[model samples]
Target: MYVQIDLDGPAGTLRVSGHGLPVVELVRAPGSPPDAHTPIGSRRRALLTLRVDGVPASIGPARGRLLRRSYRVDARVGGVRYRLMPCGYEHSALSRDGRRIGTLQSSGDGRVVDEWEGAPDPLDLVLGTALAAAFGTGAAPWWETVGDIVGELIP
Candidate 1:
């Protein structure tokens, strides 16, 4: 089963729905900086919180390794450590214990594809989408920045 996330919803909100899953709403907390304005090829670090159906879900701080492009966010939902990270360009992978359980497409209307054996739990769907919406796709390949710099130097 795959959860479809609509990022084009009303400002500060995302809508998640899929097979056998109730329509879940994720709302960005007020005062959080929007991730859309981040420049390409730069690391994204947005301190944001999303409310699941009006209840605040505690999402841990996003972490990144020095000199690495991968960005990660860790959340303990019901005591299970869940991690969300970029597995590819514009794609966010959801994993537990180093195993990818799902993926969220960050472009356009996002979609969370489930790799779990059965229908995805509602909480996981919400968490994955929340993390993706918060930090996904603000950066591009490092070479893009270098290319831009070279273009400027030549001109």
Candidate 2:
């Protein structure tokens, strides 16, 4: 699947579109953590707002630390679970039940690339890109709310 992540904006909004999937827009939630304005905690945060095909949805981190050494965090959008793991050279794998269903890749000159394993949910790709962009900041940071997604849930 073809996905594009746009980060060139003050809002840090991420837009993903392509591959017959619904377009999704992700935005960081307030108090979610690691925002430049906040202090204390890791750069990895789990709260965000996702708009899939113009319908809004919420995604947030689940309690408990990740047991897998390769993965960074576990997040949920409704009942769906998403695991973000590190992959080959600047690439991240977004999986469900240990199966890689999506991926996020970053390149020089500030371009983000993404691909899906099959016909995965568009929101999965959206969440992957949001986390990728958030943690990609690579600077002193803290944990904050990120955001609480609300509105339509893509099926």
Candidate 3:
């Protein structure tokens, strides 16, 4: 199965859609603050809300580690707790109860890959892609270096 996440929507919004899946929309909660500190060249963290077919489905925070490039997000979708964390370079593992059920490539194309038999649930795909988009992928620009240096000096 193939899933795609589109980040070209209006500010603070993401769209996830693919064949055989209903389009899911994720919107950043208003007034959500960026993480105070993040690993150099990594994306800043934010909290987001996921909606399926215009109904609130789940909410979570996506955050990056300080001094490391890894990131993770925790959310309860359909009453089942799920976590999305970096499993390798440019990809993230989606797990529940410590078992990885899927992987999402946050880099080029933003594809979600199922690790188990049969296609992944639509909610899992939406939650993983939403978290990935909010947390971002790959290296950030040079400005992040300045921010990191400044953050250290201030604290």
Q: Number of the top candidate by lDDT? A: 3
> Sort by lDDT, best first: what order?
3, 1, 2
Query: Measured by TM-score, how close is model 2 to the native structure?
Result: 0.51
Compared with the true structure, what per-residue lDDT tens digits does model 1 show for residues 1-155? Answer: 56566664325556666777655554555555445432111122243444555555555544453312446677665456788766566666678656678876554345434344355567777667656654453344557656767899995
Candidate 3, residues 5-90, lDDT tens digits: the string is: 77642245577777877677766545554332321112423445667667666555444444223356666655678877765555
Better of 1 and 2 by TM-score: 1
Give the per-residue lDDT digits (tens) of candidate 2, residues 1-155: 66665663334456666767667666665544444521112333444556667766544432322222323556555566667655544576777656788777654223556777876576676666655654431221112112212223333
lDDT value, candidate 1, whole model: 0.55
The segments of candidate 3 whose C-alpha lies over 4 angstroms from its true place after superposition are 1-4, 29-47, 67-70, 108-118, 137-155
What local lDDT score does residue 22 receive in model 3, on the 0 to 100 scale?
66
Number of clashes in model 1? Answer: 0
Which segments of model 2 are wrong by more than 4 Å?
29-47, 54-56, 61-71, 107-110, 114-130, 137-155
Best by TM-score: 3
User: In order, what lDDT does every prediction score?
Assistant: 0.55, 0.53, 0.57
Our tally of clashes for model 3 stands at 0
